[model samples]
Target: MSKLPLDPDVADVAPTDSALTPYDNQHIVTYARLLQAESEGADWREVARIVLHIDPDHEPDRAQNAYLSHLARAKWVTGQGRLLRGAGSN
Candidate 1:
C-alpha cells in the first residue's frame, strides 16, 4: 500500500531525523489537522472525512483505521518530528 492513503504525493508516515521519509516531510498539514481535531474533541469520523477524505459511513473500517493511524503518526510527528524541525520540520 502507499505510504499516504489519499494523496500519494503527500507522505503520511514519520521516520527519524537522519532517516527522513517523504511522509514525514509532506504530511505537515495533515498532522496539524489531527492536532486541531484532538484539541477540539472532534469525532473521528468527521476528522476522517475532513482531514483524510475517507468517509466513515461508507467504509467504516478503512475510514476509522485511517483516522486513527494518521492521528497517531501526527502525534508522533508533533513530538519526534520537532527534533528534526530545522531539517524536515514535519
Candidate 2:
C-alpha cells in the first residue's frame, strides 16, 4: 500500500460496488473513523461533520447520503477485506 492520507477529501457520493474502488483504498482511514463512530453510537450528523467533513445542518440530503453510503462501504470492507477489521473479528 502507498502512503494514504489520514484525512482525505470526501466525495458527496461514494462509488457503489461489491469490489473495492480506488476511492476506498485512499479513504481507509475515513472508513475506520466512520466505523469507530458507528461503534460508539455517535450521531450520524456529528460523524458526517467530524469524520466526513460534511456539515449535515447545511446540506441535509448530501450529508445523509454521503454518510450512509460511506458507512455502508466501511462495513462492507470490514466484511470483505481484513484491512480494517480487528484481529478478533477473525
Candidate 3:
C-alpha cells in the first residue's frame, strides 16, 4: 500500500500560521480539501477528525482550534498569501 502524505511527523503536511512563511508545497492537496470543505459548509469537527486526524471527541477544544487555525491559514494562502508566494504570475 502506498503511504499517505498525512504523516504527523512530516512537518509541511499541515499549514503554519506565519504569513511570511512560504506556503508548504506538500500541503497543496490538504489545502484543497480544506477549501472544498469550507465551500461545502462541512463541520469543523468532522474536518478536524477526517482531514487533520484530530479527534474532537477526545480533545474537543484542541480539535476545534486546530481546525479553525489550519483553515484560516489555508484561506490566507489562497488569498493574500498566494500573492506573497507569487502564485498568479506562474
Estimated TM-score per prediction? Answer: 0.71, 0.86, 0.66
Question: Which candidate gets the maximum TM-score versus the true structure?
Answer: 2
Q: Model 2, residue 13: displacement in angstroms?
A: 1.8
Query: Which stretches of model 1 miss by more than 4 angstroms?
Result: 1-19, 81-90
Off by over 4 Å in 2: 85-90
RMSD of each: 5.9, 3.7, 5.4
Ranking by TM-score: 2, 1, 3
Q: List the residue pairs that clash in candidate 3.
A: none
CA lDDT of each candidate?
0.65, 0.84, 0.64
| Highest lDDT model number | 2
Q: Which ten residues in a row have the lowest lDDT in candidate 3?
A: 4-13
Q: Candidate 2: give the clashing pairs.
A: none
Give the better candidate number (1 or 2) by TM-score: 2
